[model samples]
Target: MKIVYKTDTLPHVQQVSELFRSSGIKRPYDDLERLQRMLEHADVTITAWDGYQLVGLARAITDFSYCCYLSDLAVQKEYQQNGIGRNLIRHLRDLLGDEVSLLLISAPSAIDYYPKLDFERTEKAFIIPRQA
Candidate 1:
């Protein structure tokens, strides 16, 4: 199964919502409008496809100069363990260049996964929980 990656395109919202649910990501799958807005506003999006199927995605908001917040990284369950997620981040980093700092708030289940991918764990971050 060959995967094609694209940076200039975004998969349909239904496809992305399905992938997020299937990949066990903590997102508001029931809120289609919110999901659509998420994709529309993200500054950078990298998607992985097998033929026409949306298999993986990495979505982020960035200024392209200082910092990048990787908001979502989801891969279809069947497509996991194949380095698709890693490669998606790699592509984002390549596009962002070395001057930008990449950051993400990991789901509780994925806390260990980031360090394995060379993402530094930080205790200095804070957030105001979403009120949705």
Candidate 2:
């Protein structure tokens, strides 16, 4: 198993969407190409692969200086509980270092998961949706 950074791996986007759906996360089926495009400017994207098969993914949007928002993260259901998620978080953190403000909106089920990755709830944090 190896975790590597890749941005143009859109062929694996269908697999990624399936993994998200299985993980109970809502995602557009046609968004694979959209995701591939988004990754073009992403600060970093880490993918866990088992010899060319993508099994997990973690991506973030950042200014490369002040702030970063973890956009999405998912591991194959069969690959869960094997520490892939933790490894993914660590990899992203190392890529960003401590200079950027890292943030993510975790699902209610992941309340415990994010903290395990050293993320904490902030009292002053809030978001106002932007026009689409």
lDDT of each: 0.95, 0.74
How far does residue 9 in candidate 2 sit from its true spot (Å)?
Answer: 5.3
Name the regions of candidate 2 deviating beyond 4 angstroms.
Answer: 1-11, 30-33, 129-132
Give the per-residue lDDT of model 1 (tens digit) for 1-132.
Answer: 999999988789999989999999989877889999999999999999999999999999999999999999999999999999999999999999999999999999999999988899999999999887
List CA RMSD, all candidates. 0.6, 2.8
Per-candidate TM-scores read: 0.98, 0.80
Candidate 1, residue 84: how far the Cα is off, in Å:
0.3
Question: Pick by TM-score: which candidate is best?
Answer: 1
Q: What count of clashes does model 2 give?
A: 0
Model 2 RMSD to the real structure? Answer: 2.8
TM-score, cand. 2: 0.80
User: On residues 1-132, what C-alpha lDDT tens digit does candidate 2 reach at each position?
Assistant: 555545445435667676677666545545777756765656677787767767777878888788889988888778788888888888777778789888998777887888878888877878887454
